[model samples]
Target: MRGDGARAWLDEGLKLLAEQGAPAVTLERLCERMGMSKGAFYHHFGSMPKFRTRLLAHFEAEYTTAIIDAVEGAGGLTARERLERVVAEAVKDTGPGLEIAMRAWAKQDPEAAAVQERVDATRIGYLRGLCEEAGHATPSRMATLLYLALIGGAHLMPPLPPAEMREMYGVLLPLLD
Candidate 1:
């Protein structure tokens, strides 16, 4: 097994989750993908529950916290500029099948549902901050609409083409300005 067996397991778990949904994220499945044994898996995670908890944490860090950090540290940008950049980046980074898989997993697992709740709150809260900074009359309402437009739009049928989505954001940007 690799030295960072835990990370490797988590990576495989994420891949399985994205490709085959959370039900496929079994220890057996992960070990099979990693070419490792149960012993190796046990060495990294004490139990399946522990592994699931850590996997959710890893997802939150990779998906939500990292994006927030990047947007906050972007230099020489106004609040609107930062918001635009975030929307543009989000349009490009769809997380492939991961978001859909997670949403489905949350429906069945309360633990996953709680994590999803926190992730949504963090993202929406950040948008609200941007709206407040830009002096929107109804920051909360604008933030909700903006977040729904970006996140909800991601799961739309025949998915929104990136160019058209960018155009939509372009139109919305002036409203925030």
Candidate 2:
């Protein structure tokens, strides 16, 4: 396919995936959305698996640079401020159902699982670095626990009121100190 065609397909595919999840990103649907032929799809992606690979790469790049960067940028701030900011930032996905959908898909798809493994490793590494910067011992283990807790809290505590969340952070932050 032409460069413009490839770009259009990828953009449309990602939008469809984010809004409706992976199952909604069928070749037929993409072709219909882009008003293109199946030949165009094959020309760029070769196959659905190839397209999925590209999509994952795009996701990794965007999430790391945007959300993760925002989280890590908290480094110069107090640890408590950092954690609260990270918590709020990580959970603030803009209609990209892809993150949660990808997590669910990881349970059954080896490729998805691999993507998640990379994401986890990156998150742990960031947290570990932060803990070290704070002069904390056992940084790796602490990073793991903190990373897991943040993810768990984000999902499980949906009704987490703002003031209560702040209070919870107040309780946990000193533990890190």
Candidate 3:
């Protein structure tokens, strides 16, 4: 409870979710992982519902908003260039594990499903804009395909390596052009 306990809970919860899925994200599990107690969690989150909501927000901030901000803030990058950079960065980020877990959680939890829907839409929207900038024949369709491929790859047994992912993007570039 001394320093940013709420963030600690969120971070641990995300780890549990990634490793063991949403069902493992209970307060007991998080507290055990953090070596804290229920009182400490209650001090920050008040209740399970509050904790769940904040956890989702934290995931969105860390996984989606941060990446978007980073891509947008990179000076002189064209939309296509930005898109490539975002995908490359994602290949290195641990957020994909959380994403894959969240997708599984979405099937049983409406709130998780709603958050997943919004996240997917926001990402696809950005992809669509980039596709339009790159002059893809059908930006919407192309964006959907690209997003699906990325999401589908996240579910792979070993996940795609960064080099292989870059190669995939290379193969995708001419199609976008």
Candidate 4:
């Protein structure tokens, strides 16, 4: 009976996804984690396909769109500041587990792959924009490096911490000067 709401289900799903990857996100496991049942899940999502669709959408909006919106909406910052904010906001978002899970899922699920692709493009595009604004001679290159460093950090055996990642960004960011 706990976690009856749709948001609850999606939130739980994201947690499961982050902890266990795509294959581990079965209704049984999800319900077990939520202390609920399949009926509650079906009541909210209607079908597995529908649920997956909604879940992917939710991840994109929460983990990607939200970060971009926040940074873009922040007023009066210089481009370098915006770039720094992008790193800070992304680190604050801290989706390493979910990021790895979604990427692994994307390898098998075309739907996930498409969403991942769009998400990547949008994230990188934002970085590139910020870099361009910062007057870098090679904005795209700088942007890609920044984006890749974050992605690479996520894949490390221990997974870099936010503090360390920010420190790393501090080092790389000066290249833009």
Candidate 5:
């Protein structure tokens, strides 16, 4: 269990992630931002890699839980509809820039990559369950394609009107049917 100070450090670290890209987040930067010395930094995390790993783990847990909850709350809804809702909520919740930062950090950090893999696996599993529930065939392939489309599309999506965000769901939702 982490004490208040440690949790504070983690909170500040995540805030930095939200404010700036991952590359710009450094131990020195955190120290300066938190108004702490090197000792305080090392007290919470032994090294930069360790801190980065924890940060990714923290983000993964929070994000995956949100996705799962969104899907689960769509009880009795069609799989496609549940998935579309998840995509929309995920985008609004995570914001475009933070999602990009996560992808960028995951690309460069093994620990972050591991968290990404776990999150992806969980998403794929959720889609598989949805397919099963809907009596759809080829759950694995469908899950893979669904995740790829949504995640990849979210990354590359250009600026859109608020209406377009919800409207895009209508366009893509049919593919799952």
Candidate 6:
């Protein structure tokens, strides 16, 4: 009841970004989608730039940091096990539209670019650590390959389905061994 209005804006705005890309996340479009008003948007975010920053932050936290935390914080898990957890999270998250859109936005917006760079570095670093822990000889290369596969899958026209993604990633399991 309290922050529900702002939360609605965030959730709906995320959907808009995923389905329609960052350009489609304007105040007019988000309000149109939510059947709300500028007053309400301002009530929650105070300004569009503030809202965009919040939206990007939410995406990074939810899609990146949260997954990393879940996998790494699970305790007693091996490097391969941590990767398996990431795969599982991939299937359960909101698919790849947001990922693709964020990456594309990074090409045009400095703020998004900064966030994207951090995310890329953080993820690849995480994967490299996992590979090293698993005794992979070329951890950085292996990690980059793994990350590239995930991003490539996002760029697919219809986007790859979750089961297919899992299967695709499964093919790399042998490399870990």
Best by TM-score: 4
RMSD of each: 2.1, 4.4, 1.9, 1.5, 3.9, 2.1
Q: Who is ahead in TM-score, 3 or 6?
A: 3
Better of 2 and 3 by TM-score: 3
lDDT of 1 by residue, 9-106 (tens): 88778888998999999988887888888888888889999999999999999788988789878888889988987887777745447878898999
Give the alpha carbon lDDT tens digit for every residue of 132-176 in model 2.
776677788878877665555545535344455446656655667
| lDDT of candidate 6 over 1-177, digit per residue (tens) | 122577688888888898999988999888788887789889999999999999888878877898899887899998899988887787665788888889899999999999999999999999899999999999999999988988888788878888888898899867988
Q: For every model shown, what is its TM-score relative to the native structure? A: 0.89, 0.69, 0.92, 0.94, 0.74, 0.91
What is the per-residue lDDT of model 5 for residues 53-99, given as tens digits with 9 covering 90 to 100?
A: 77877777667776688667768877666776676665564455655
Better of 2 and 4 by lDDT: 4
Candidate 1 global lDDT: 0.84
lDDT scores in order: 0.84, 0.70, 0.84, 0.90, 0.71, 0.86
Candidates ranked by lDDT, best first?
4, 6, 1, 3, 5, 2
Model 1 TM: 0.89
Single out the weakest 10-residue window by summed lDDT for candidate 1: 88-97
Q: Model 3: per-residue lDDT, tens digit, 58-163?
A: 8888888888889989989987898788878767756467878999989999998999899999989988998899888899998898888788777788877667
What would the per-residue lDDT of candidate 4 be over residues 76-95, giving only the tens digit for each residue?
88999888888998776455
Comparing 3 and 5 on TM-score, the stronger one: 3
Single out the weakest 10-residue window by summed lDDT for candidate 2. Answer: 157-166
Backbone clash pairs for candidate 2 read none
**Clash tally, candidates in order:** 0, 0, 0, 0, 0, 0
lDDT of 1 at 59: 91
Candidate 4 minimal-lDDT segment of 10 residues: 86-95
Higher lDDT: candidate 2 or 6? 6
Candidate 2 at residue 51, lDDT?
91
